[model samples]
Target chain A: MRLFRSTLTALALALPLAAPTLGLATSAHAAPYTIDNSHTSVLFKTTHLGVSPFWGRFNNVTGSFQYDAAKVDASKVQFEIDVNSVFTADKKRDDHLKSPDFFSAKQFPKITFESTSVKAGKAAGSLSVTGTLTVRGTKKTITVELAKTGEGKDPWGGERIGFEGSFVINRLDYGVSYMPEGLGKDVTIVVAVEGIKG
Target chain B: MDPILALAFGVVVPALVALAFVVVLRRPFARTARGGETDLPAPWAAGFGLAAAYGIGVGLLLGWPDLPPVDVTLVAPWAAGVAAFLGLIRDGRVRGAASGVLGLGLGVFMTGPIEDMTLRVGLIAGVTASMVALERGLARLSERLDPRGAALSQIVLVSGAALAVLFSDTASLAQATGGLAAGLGALFTLGLLWPRAAVLTRAAPAVAAILVTNLWGTTLFANGHPAVLAALTLAPLLVSFIPPLAASRRAILRIAVPAALIGIPIAAAGAFAGLRYFATEDASASEHATGPTDPTSPSAATPATPSGTPTTSGTPTTPGTSGYDPGYGY
Candidate 1:
C-alpha cells in the first residue's frame, strides 16, 4: 500500500512536467504566415475569341494564412485581391474588366476568399482548400488544390513557405457574363504565394 | 470589343423587334383611342413596346440584371420598366409627378451606396427637375417637330451618347445605349415605311425617361465624362432654337435641320472623347517604354482613378515558343 501511494505521487509530478512540452509541440504545428506580396502572383488565363488563351494578372494581393502541416485540415487561408489591380497589358481591356460588366471595381472593390474547409489532397504535401469566394458581391464556394512548393529559412533569417495552386472557374457564374461568345466562360486561375512566418 | 456581336445584338435584332412591335400595335392602339379621341390618348401602348424591346436587347447582349441590383448596369432594365409604367397614366400632372419620383429614386440609387448625403440630395433635385422638364420638352417637340423629326432626334441623341460612353472605356454601358438607339431607329424606320401608322404620342414619356436616366447613369457609374453627357442632354434642346418651320419650307428640311442642330453637341462630344482616348493611350505607351522604376512601390499597387484613363505601367510578358497571342486579335 505504501509503494502504491509512492508510485501515484510520482505519476502526478510527471504529468505536470510533461504538459508544457505537449503544449509546445501542438503550438509548433500551428504557425502563422503573412503573405509576401512582392514575390506572390495571382495569374489568370481566359480564352479569347475561342481561339487562344489570354493571360492577365492582379498586381495587388494581400492576405495571411494559418498552416498546420501535421493536420492539413486544420489549415486556413484568406486572400483579398484588388479588382482595380487587374492588368491585361491593354488598358482598354483592363478598363472594361473593371467596369460594371465584370468586376465592377468601383462598386465591388475587393475580390476575397476565406477558407471554409481544408482536406488532404491526392498528392503528398498538398491540400484541398474549399472557400467562399466573393467577386462583385456574389459569393460562391470554390475548391483549390494547393501543392507546397517549399518551406525553408531565407537569407535574412526569416522563415518562408510557398504554395502554388491552380483552379478553373466560370466567370459567368460570378455575374461577369459579358460577351458570352467572344470571351470564354471558363477561366483558369493560378495562385502562387510566398509567405513569411509571422 | 467584338464588332460583329455588338452589331448583331445591340443594333439589328433590337431594331427588327421594335419595328415589328410598333407596326403590329398601331391599328389596335388607335382603336383604343378612337372611342376617346382622334388618336391614342393612352401613353404606354407604344412606350411599353419600345422599353420591352430595349430590355430584351440589353438581356441578350449583357445578361439580364440581378434582383436588387447593385450597379447602374443592373438597374437599367428596371428603370426602363418604371419609365414604361409612367407612360400608362393619361393625366399629365400625375405622370409628371411619377416621373419626378422615378428620377429622384434613380439619382439616389445609381450613384452606388457610398455617396455622401449632400451629394445625394443634390443629385435627387437635379434629376427630378431634369425628368419633369425633359418630359414636357419632349411633349412639345413631338407636337412641333412631328413624329419623324422627334424619332430622328432621339436616334441621334442616343447614338451620340453611345459613342461617347464607348470612348469612356465602358463598353457594356455603350452597348446598352447602342441597343436603345437601334430601338429608336426602328421607330423612325416604321414612320418611313407606313406614314399613316406614324404615331409617337405614346412613346414620348418613355423616350425622355430612358434618355435622361441612361445619360445620368453612364456619367455617374461608368466613368463617362460629365461635360460630354451634359452636352448630349442639351443637344435635343437645340432643336427648340430653330424657329418655327414655315409650311413653304422644304418638307425634308424639317427633319434635316433638327438632325443637324442636334448633331453639333454630339460631334463635339465625340471629338473630345477621341482626343482624351488618344492622350491616355500615348501616356500609357510612354509609361510602358520607361518601365516601372520600382517593383515594390505603392504606385505599382494603385490602379487608375475613375477618370476614364488607365495609367498603370504593367509590361506584358511575351508568350514565347508557344505562338500564343495575348495582344489584340483584331
Candidate 2:
C-alpha cells in the first residue's frame, strides 16, 4: 500500500514535468486565437478619380484565426466583414454606396475571406495567406501578405498575438462597377489584428 | 479597330439592312396615302433600321469576342429595342393616346431589370411631363410651325439626347443607341423634307417618343438635379415658338435660332457626361479624416465576433456609427 502511494505521488510529480513535453509534442497543434477587437484596425484605401488616394473602413468586422507558430504553413484565418457597416463619413455617398450602384449591402450583407493555403513568405516573419475573398456575391482568390509584429502577455494577464496584412483588390472583379470615376476600382485593404490567445 | 472604325462596323449592319429595306421595298409601299405622295420610305423602313442597328447590331458587337475593353451594360440596347418595337406597333396599328400610355408603362417597367428602378421611374415620368408641356406649348404657337417642322424638331431633339448619352458614362450604350438614333434621325430629316416621302414621316412623333425614353432610361444618372434631359426635351419645342414672335420667315435666322436653342441643352448634357462626378466621401470633414489613411496603417483592429471568437479593429469606432456629408442628396 505504501509503495502504491509512493508511486502515485511520484507519478503525479512526473506528470507536471511531462506536461510540457506533451505540449511540445502537440506543438504542431494550432492555437485558436479570437480577434481582439479593441486592438484591431481594418482599413482600405483607393485612388480618387484614379489620382489622389481616398480611404474607407468597415465598422463591423469579425473573424477568428488558427495559428501554429512552429507550423507556420498551417496557420489559417477567416474574416466576415459586415458590408452594411461601411462608413465613408459622407451620408449621401454612404446611401449611394449602399444602394445598388455599389455594395448592395442589403442583398450581400457580409464580405467573407477564408484562407485556402498558407506559406511562409520569402521575407522573414511573414506569411502569404492565399484565400477566397467574396464580396457582393462574387468570389476571387487573392494572397494577402501578413507579417507578424510581436506576441506577448498584456497587463491584464491576457496572452495576445499581433499581425498586420495588406492586399490590393479590384472592385470591378466583385461587380461594384458603379460610379467608376467617383470611386476607384482598385481598393487596397490593410488589416491589423491583435488576437487573444484562447 | 479604331473608334471611328468601330462605329462604322457597328452601324454598317443596320445601314445595309436599311438600304436593302429602302431600296428593295420602295415600289410596293411607295403608293400614296389619301392626302398625297411623299419622299420618305414607308414608316416600317425607319423603324426596321433603328431596331436593326441599335437593337440587333449593338447586340452583335457587344457580344463579339474581340472588341476594345469597355465597361457597360446592355440595358440601353434592350430598352431601345422595346421602344422601337412598341413605337412601331403604335405607328403601324395601335393608334391614339392610350397606346402612348401603354408604351410609357411598358417602357418604365422594362427598367425593372436594371438597378434603382425608383430612380428610373422618376426619369421616365419627368420626361413624360416635360414632353407633355412642350406639346401644349406647340399648340399655342401653331401658326409658326407645320408637321414637318415639328417632326424634324423632335428628330433633332432625340438625336441630341442620343448624342449626350453617347458622350456620357457608358460606351456600349453610346455606340448602340447613338448609331441607331443617327440612322433614324437622318432618315427622318431626309424623308420628311422629301415631297414623295412625306407619308413615311407621318407618325414620327409617336416613334420619337418611345425611342427617346430608352435614351434616358438606360443611363446611370438618367435624372440629375438640374434635370438636364427634361430641359433638352423641352428645348426644341420652345425654340419652335420663337420664330413667330420675331415674325420672321428668314431661313438663316430660323436655322440659327434653333441651332443655338438646341446647343444649350446638348452642352449641358455633355458637361454632365464628361465633367460631373460624385464628390468622393473623403471630401467631407470627418473626425476620422486625418488625410487619407494609408492602406497599410497598422492602427487597425476588429472587435470580437458574436461567436466569442476574438476579432480585431484598430482605433475601433463603435459599431453602427454614423457621420457623412449632408450637402447633397444626389
Best DockQ among the predictions, by candidate number: 1
Q: What TM-score does each of the candidates earn?
A: 0.83, 0.49
How do the candidates score on chain B by TM-score? Answer: 0.79, 0.58
Q: On a 0 to 1 TM-score scale, where does candidate 2 land against the true structure?
A: 0.49
Which residue pairs does candidate 1 place in steric collision? none
In terms of lDDT, the poorest run of 10 residues in model 1 chain A is: A21-30
Q: In model 2, where do residues sit more than 4 Å from their true spots?
A: A1-198, B4-6, B9-40, B56-74, B90-177, B185-223, B236-330
Task: Provide the global lDDT of candidate 1 against the true structure.
Answer: 0.73
lDDT per model, in order? 0.73, 0.55
**Candidate 2 docking class:** incorrect
DockQ value for model 2: 0.09
Q: Compared with the true structure, what per-residue lDDT tens digits does model 1 show for residues B44-112?
A: 555776777678887887777777875665676777778887877877668777878887887777665
Question: Each prediction's DockQ?
Answer: 0.25, 0.09
